[model samples]
Target: MEATISLTSQDVTKQDPTALFSPKNPIPMETIFLSNIDQAVVFPVETVFFFQVPPTKASSTLNICEVVKRAVAEVLLVPYYFMAGRLNFNHGSNRLELVCNNAGVMFVGATSRLALKDLGNLSLPNASFHRFIHRPGLYKSLDETPLFTIQVTRFKCGGFALGFMTNHAILDGKSASEMFHNLASICRGEGLKTHVFPNERTSLRARNPPQIKFPHNEYVKIPKIPSLATSFTTQNQTSPSPLIFSNKYDHKLFHFTPSMLKSLKDKAITKTSSFEAIVAHLWRARTKVVFGNTDELSTVLFAVDIRKKISPPLLAGFVGNGVVTAFATAKVRDLVERPFCFCVEKVREGGERVTSEYVRSVVDWLEVYKGIPSTCNGNNFYVSAWWKLPFNELDLGFGRLVHGGPIVSGNDEFVLLLEGNGGGINVWLGLEREKMKRFMNHVFDI
Candidate 1:
């Protein structure tokens, strides 16, 4: 038998996308100013969560799309009504702001000719997963495009996939996950009746006198040369680096059992967390395979939740971009030649630096250097830990949440860490096809 059936664009038929509004509550028809960090991330983030048909008799007849659509329009939109707003550039502030005019979010319902099994191994990453998400098209401006879009694709076997695309300027990953949890809760009849989410964008606003205390090496005014080159000569040695072209990549899921993670932690210095230990291992391993020259510098960039890192702590209900980038940089020689603990300590120090004062400084820094983008090249490796996020527990009242994560990694220089079934960690990463073979050899050898 064939391992998996082919899923074509024709297999999935979508309904005419509709605009969904808050059915009962009337929100303020005003503009909300987004923070500098929010303005920095203007791109869209797409994620898909899969659910199997529930075993219970009552759930078997549930209309996954209708129920979810109703829950979003009636229950979720009250607090998260900002999601229905449109994004526009504010000429006065010279920044992008959200116009809370209740423009309504785009909701698309789809049906697939294939069943849940035909897609094959939902646990694995596949580019075809994009079929589940709805993009507003390439030509639309910010005001014309919907800040949030939801696509519900029902499978032949009654299983369903909940796909969402949100403007990063309005909501980050954490806030988006919570919104889904709220929707799921409503579908199960256990959701909040009067949920009021705190919009704390003003709290993170830049100070009148911006205080940029820390030297933010993460953001740069000018782009650097491509770190992974076809040929390069270090001070001590000369060699041709890996012939990895830009945009040609492959993604894979690397599973690490609890014991395997424990072993990694055991190998590192005492008190090293699984995240730090695993990241250190990945950084070192990828550097070994990609960087031929010892002197070449490699940087690991990751996001730090600043909700509690600031003074007085951001409110638990505060739902906006509450994350800042934290990174560690070291010479390829140091990462490869030094002991495993060396890399772990470097990773730890980066996180330790994200104190209350540091978060404020990050806000101020972005204020001064408006639109400064983070450095992204072969030398930069981005890591996002979603293991603690509530993806697995997101039961949309349809059935069991079998698997959930990014539809597909849009960037090759990125990695996503998610919680795995059976108490393990799943490393979903993308890399050049040739270097991946060498990376697999070095990842677990430590």
Candidate 2:
């Protein structure tokens, strides 16, 4: 389903809130400390959402660019931090802060002749689909990149592809999607319903006099990789030459129906949860495919959202990094050779360790270490769930979305769990080229 999606004469312009603060009356100099979790990643998180049709005629007679430009201007009035904040690494001060500099977000427009049906089911993303984005990787410098950007590609069949890449330091998947939904509402004439107050990240910041009592063996420092080059393609399948793509990871989407997932849950070693069961199965399947034996050690990492779990609880619309990593370490043999429930129970235990107290301890631990964020290597396995997010709420004037999730790069080190259209789960797995092919075969065989 590949076609020319030419982005001709793209009017790339900054969409700031209707010129409120000028140079004469500049915004107040405000800065927020980026937490260790926020500073962990040096790359931007990219996502593309496809709609069934164009914006409703009743909504406006304006083109997609006009509609988006108008909507972004309005949305920025409320989520003003998005327009006002800029990332700056003070070499002299030795820190990264979100400087409220009244800067703006990037907006781009493009067109495609292909129809939604011609492209077939976009339940999963592939390589040719990368044209829908403007920037899919990290920028050279902080000033060169805005915290957020939007690219809309309209099709001839009355449909469009809306893609965005937001800096991970400013927003995670949860916060970024919410901002888009808010923008969608604005485009639909609903106006702003969200009351997001900026700078709430301080609540989760590392204490000045940091204290750490609980053990933090799970969060080992991520050793620097020799290479810093970034990739922009999602090698959805492996074929032709494995040697050419061997250096790049392969990604594929696997769907599990409601009945199938339920059956898996029932067959757990003990009374295991749905997530734990799936992670256990994947943990075993991946280990088996990659290493071919239970010889070497394998680790599975999952993040915990401490928004509500923390004491006193965080307020609504508190945009900041709130997730802490939790991981399980086991030998390949122990993971694949053991019973299903054995792996499930092990994963459960690892997650249980991320209690409120434990999360607070992590904050202090990071502060004590000067905010050196916890990093994961390619050898480790990480799982993230987007099923709970309000993905279906992306009603950008066109009824709802046809497909949505991340525009996963060619990195097999990450896995994303999304809600399927058939009341099930869609597992987007990225693995080594040959390992992915074998892993899919092994999963089907089971």
Q: Candidates' lDDT values, in order?
A: 0.77, 0.65
Model 1 per-residue lDDT tens digits across residues 344-390: 99899889889988888888987876633354555677787978776
Candidate 1, superposed: residue stretches over 4 Å from native:
1-6, 24-28, 54-59, 191-194, 222-247, 371-375
Per-residue lDDT of 33 in model 2: 75
Q: What is the Cα-based TM-score of model 2? A: 0.84
Stretches of candidate 2 above 4 Å error? 1-26, 54-62, 136-139, 214-218, 222-247, 292-295, 370-376
Residues 296-397 of candidate 2: C-alpha lDDT, one tens digit per residue:
778787777777887757777767666777877788888877777778888898888877777778888765544322223456667878776777768877
Write down the RMSD of all candidates, one decimal each: 6.2, 5.7
TM-score of each: 0.89, 0.84
